[model samples]
Target: MSMTITEKILAAHVDADEVRPGEIIDCRVDFVFANDITAPLAIQEFQKMDIPQVFDPDRVAFVFDHYVPSKDIASAQQCKITRDFVRAHDLPHFYDIGRSGIAHVLLAEEGFVGPGDVFVGADSHTCNQGALGAFATGVGSSDLAAAMALGRLWLRVPETVKYVLRGKLQPWVTGKDLILAIIGRIGVDGARYGAMEFAGEALAHLSMDERFSITNMAVEAGAKNGIMEPDDVTLAWFRPRARRSSAMYRSDPDANYADVRDIDASALETVVSVPSSPGNVVPVREVAGVKVDQCFIGTCTNGRIEDLRMAATVLAGRKVHAETRLLVIPATPRIYRQALEEGLIQIFLDAGGAISTSTCGPCIGGHMGVLAEGEVCVSTSSRNFIGRMGHRQSQVYLSNAGVAAASAVLGRLAHPDEVVRAPVPV
Candidate 1:
């Protein structure tokens, strides 16, 4: 009996010859993380354990990102708690405002994550790191606290859903659009408690950033985790940054899949997830001309150098519509610096978009650019649950950076090409 990558990795870490889905097993973790939103509670739980010290302080990371610059008094206290824990433990991986961005992006850019490693974070999008071919997932405060204290956690192996995607994507179509399409096709809970393994020849055309975008949204479909098989592209990205090398894992030739599906990548179009749920997706053209009060082009799901460049290309010589506020946040501080060096920041500023520090800002309604009552926003952030970004009455439309940027220019939902092909000057 052959095993999928998720099974193989779990089995190896648990020192088992083989493992099957539904089997509960304890496995050591390569990395554990928590953010300002969840770390305070996890810290309280960790203190309750009465451990002299954490299992390995180096293996644990604390990032203050959810409400950077501190949204309010309560948020400030939460960040302070994380800082106190870091100082007490002398944890080198722990980071404060400037040194950290979003925990998921910071970990990857700063070399704390890589292929075949098991990573757990107190963030649902922690699975965002799985783009590098790792078995990463998000857990609750209690599970994260325990993992921090004991350096291990119990997991019920998830059966695999193999997506054998094949075809070249349309020019304006992106990983964000592709994932939204998947969510639309499957509904939100389509892959509940399952591991999503993306395979097939189409993987060859995807960049590491693109692959990360796809897996980062696996949680939207209720998957336990998402993974990609490592090849030369992964090794190239990891070779220069990995602190420790681990054996690369892949599914066996005859690995059994719980279900198999195929997506015609070439047929995908830029799409948006309407307010209230990520699964409520439709093509960009369907929603074109829908008025918007704001547009945001960054989040763990679509915030990176590549995403920044795409948005800049759209807004290079244009200005944001007077009625719409555009906010562009890079996912990590390093990406922030790179954007500045490339003059992307200037392009954003000149185009009337506000350039902010790398923080989850506004994505979680923490601060920076929250929507108001009855407001409509075209955002590139993940999750559009009612009240997810602001007041329950405010609406959020989720789409790629291209669509988000274009919407800001027109003050209405539209595709990137629509703006470019228009007759009037932006």
Candidate 2:
């Protein structure tokens, strides 16, 4: 039976000869994780099972990110609960305050997940790992608890929606723009309960970091998961940091797909998702000149070193608009350190942007850079739902780091070309 990459991985995990879409199967999970914001609930549920220990300490991870460096008493207490649980279980993958970063990005950086694995996390953006060809998805706390205890999960296989990318990308246009354009074309529920499989010759042009950005927002389009086949680019990035053996999987040429969409990458422009909905996307020029009070560049979606390099290139010799506040955060300690070594951090500071420790702080409105009511912000984070970053009335426009940096300088939503006539070397 021909199978898609998603089906191949799912079938392999379950020791099955074949699995069809909508089929319920019990599959072993290669990795399971939860962050500070979601781990406490999962821990409580796990305790109810009276399980003395996790299925495998090495395969479970706990990341303290959302409000780490605890913003308030409530958040501090939440971390305490998960920390205590991790210590009790002697979990080897516990990431605390100083070592913590966004769970999705941190897991990939540490090589906790890789090709042909089934990864489940309590965070929606867990789909980010799919860039490595993993069948990764987000689950509820109860489901997380079950997976942690049993090392297995029940999944209803999803039909696949294959997106074929052809042609080269334009300058300053990235995977973020591609995804926003996708969401805009096919509303938020377009791929609901289906696997979004990305393929085509254009994959060769997208870096691993950009691929991660694309998969990270799969949930925003209501997909069950988003995945790319394990190609040379994915292998080059995963092989060095891989902590365990990984199997590479690809879709059979004759595999069935629920739908197929072809995208012309060269035609894509730097795009942004307007306030309140990721599906509300348009070219950067469409919303240019709209006033912005803040600009944020960080999160699992676009916080990689590549993203910082792009932002730095634009902000290198310029100053941030005096009326606007720009906040720059690296997604992980390692990324933060690399930015410092590369002088990316200095360029941001010199441009009047504030740098933060690795955390999801401002992205979640937990602390740092929360917006005032009716204010406008241009962010590189994943979602921009109502009250996602602060006051319900505050508006957030989602864009790639370059666009966000350019917007910071113009004090409004602007195209990267509006600020940099010639790109500066980072």
Candidate 3:
């Protein structure tokens, strides 16, 4: 039987010669992750157990991302518990508020994950690491506790759904649009519990950041995870880390693909995930003229330096609409420091955008940019479920940071081309 990249990784984890899609195989997890929101409970559960030592302290990652700086008293206590656990176990990797970004981005930036590995995290977006070709997935708190106790977790090998993308995207189109359009075709649960493998010519044109934008939202499609082959761009990112961490690997050429879905990237225009759900998608032009109260750029979805640069291209020398409150958050403290050095922060501030600390912020609605009742906001965050950004009546439009920046300036749904286009190489 031919095995896809995901199946190959799962097989490697289980020490199997070959594993087929849809076949249930209990495999060991290579690493485990828990963020501030879930780490407290997981640690409490771990305390109930009498494990001598964690399977591998180095294999465990604890990040203070969701409630970084602790929004409230309860959140502060939760993070304190996580800090205590990390110190007690002597885990090698601990990302505090100033150092941590979104768990997914920070994971890759720090070289904690690699291809052909089976990794699990206690948060839903844990699948984001799959962009690097690792078979990463999300699990519950109990599972995290068990992984900490034994340094191993189990998984059912998932069936894979391949997306064969073709053609270069037109101006204003981005990986966010590609994934949102796919969600439209497959509906919210179309790929539920299945791995999404992106391939073909269109994928080659996508940058690592863009591929991340696709993989980060795979959970919304009900996927086990989403992955792309490691190309030169990925290698460039990995090679440096390999000098310190273990080496990384690409998917073997003979890797098998289970099902292939083709997409025309050029045909993809700007897409918007309307309020209350990621599946509520439509072309941006269709929703033009609708006014919004706020616009936010930055999240695990599209908060990298490149994403900020794209927004800066739109916001430079332009004022945000008076009625719209625009907020820009860098994904991590490192990214924030880079933006400062690159003058990106000045551009955003000059455009009347509020800069947020490197935390999840309004992406999960803890604070920073919560919307009021009946307010409409354009954002670069992952989900838009009910009350995701604030009051239940508040509406959210999900797009790339480029679109969010453009909409902030225009006070309505606007395309990236209307504000900023991909920079032409000099």
In order of appearance, the predictions have TM-scores of 0.98, 0.98, 0.95
* lDDT by residue for model 2 (74-191), tens: 9999999998998888889999988988899999999999999999999999999999999999999999999999999999999999999889889999999998989999889999
Which residue segments of model 2 deviate by more than 4 Å?
Answer: 422-426
Q: What is the lDDT of residue 180 in candidate 2?
A: 90
Please list the C-alpha lDDT of all candidates, in the order they appear: 0.89, 0.93, 0.84
Best by lDDT: 2
Candidate 1 residue lDDT tens string, 360-392: 888888799988999999988889999888888
Where model 1 places Cα greater than 4 Å from the true spot, the runs are 423-426
Candidate 3: tens digits of C-alpha lDDT, residues 1-426: 556778777777778888876677767887888999888888878878877567888788898888767879988999889888788878888998777888888888878887666778999888888877788889888889898787666666777778989999876688888999999889889889898888889978888888888998999999988887777777777767642333244455666655678888888888999877899899998888789899999888899999998899888888898899899989988889999999999999989999988878889888888889999999999889989999999989999888899899889889867665544223
